[model samples]
Target: MRMRITRRGGLVGLAAVAALLVGASPASAAPGDASAYAAKIQVTLLGQPAVTAGPFAEAKADGPTANSLATVHLPGILDTGVLNASASRDDQTGAVQSKASTADVRLTVLGALGAEGAGTRQGVGNNTVGAQLIEAECHATQQGVAGSTKLVGVDLGSLGSVDATPAANTTIQVSALGVDVARIVFNEQIHNADGSLTVNAVHVTLLGGVLGSIGSGDVILSSATCGPAGLPIPMASGAGLWLGLGLLGIAAAPAAVVINRRRRPASALAAEAD
Candidate 1:
């Protein structure tokens, strides 16, 4: 048995599909900044800022550009060389990617000088981190997101020990006099409530009052954030709008033609047939 679909019914179905294309786009729905930072350091005394290094190597999708910085030092506290950050976005596809990197990092602390005479050193030869978000338009999770971090010659030193390749969000802390003194987190990743993603290659913080208003600092390295945004929405002007209009017209064409032909007189149809 053969089943025939009426022209009106097919047209209605096509119209519905066009409506979906114009009204909804799941992959590129979220909105947020795609950004990255290479490194920074801040020290506070009793919660007041004292020394600062940089939030320098930074990138953002506002301009969809990359940036870098070279050789930063704060004697006895921080030293680093060669930092880079970059971000890119496809406006038509609504895809974004971000990255950050750093080399020759060393953070030192003297218990006597600031740790109240406790010696500690945090070190790393080089590191890189990256994140990407693509629209889930065509495939299910494939090419949708990519994230990773790499580190070489890491010396946790007194900051706390860890495997060369630490797991995500690996943490270490130092305490004294039954109070927390310092903390470090490695390879951290977070998912925002707004459906965005953030990655931090390293984070360090030192609380004040280790030896009466002595040590206080906060630092971050190789950080990136990106929107889980997806494919472009079609409701706006240009190609998307034209595409929608074209689909609607095609769908309505058969139905309109069938209705008009049915209303014409049988003699007119016979004359055409003759």
Candidate 2:
């Protein structure tokens, strides 16, 4: 006589099959775990409040003076995760010849990474593993019209990779954003039972400018599949989101000025007419 499997047993078998499919899929199917982490970078140019230099007259030159500020926040979820990050800034001319000039063209950057959390290895229980790392870096620089380059950067390498059991070897989502900068990167490595290794690399880079004006940029992302090669799924979602937000800011700048002008009293607005 034929035997019938119980409904509960059928469901259990389906779950097992699904898990096997996910684990057996190529590396291309999973991107590094970036969705769990978020980063924001902001730069403000204080600009020269008052130009002390007289027209056609040069003031005494002082050494290049720079003021830079940076901050990073790592959530508990990503604590102990590895992070290797850096940032930089520069003027179109690329050189800050003097303190006053440096003030005229200042740069800043900020970044952070999520630390890996505690968990068991996939398919293997009872073993504890270390958290993964979140890496980041930032910097700024100045260049003279003659092509001299002066650059400064800050590196945050505390987050990059972590030790975790197989339970932590699942797929990870990622997102990244930046402005007027060169590159953003996130990567991961996979080790199989056979001892072979696979490395996944994802990065965003900025290129192109015209006559002192920054140009449009191109972004590319990998699909959520690694195939046989362990390539990180480069998701442009982060950069795209940032790009869209930046555009909105630019579009609103003029509106903000108009609104501020309108809010002023009529007498204040007409004061210059006297």
User: Candidate 1: which pairs clash?
Assistant: 27-230, 28-230, 28-231, 111-115, 111-116, 111-117, 111-118, 112-117
Task: After the best TM-score superposition of candidate 1, give how far the Cα of residue 28 lies from its true spot, in angstroms.
Answer: 4.3
lDDT of 2: 0.25
lDDT of candidate 2 at residue 181, scale 0 to 100 = 30
RMSD of 2: 33.2
lDDT for each of the candidates? 0.60, 0.25
Candidate 1, lDDT over the whole model: 0.60
Q: Put down candidate 2 lDDT per residue, 12-95, tens digits, no spaces.
A: 445545544444444332212111111222222123121121111111112112222222222211112112221111222221
Q: Against the hidden reference, what TM-scores do the models get? A: 0.63, 0.15
Any idea how many clashes model 2 has?
59
The CA lDDT at 262 in model 2 is: 65
Which whole-number lDDT from 0 to 100 does residue 161 have in model 2? Answer: 33
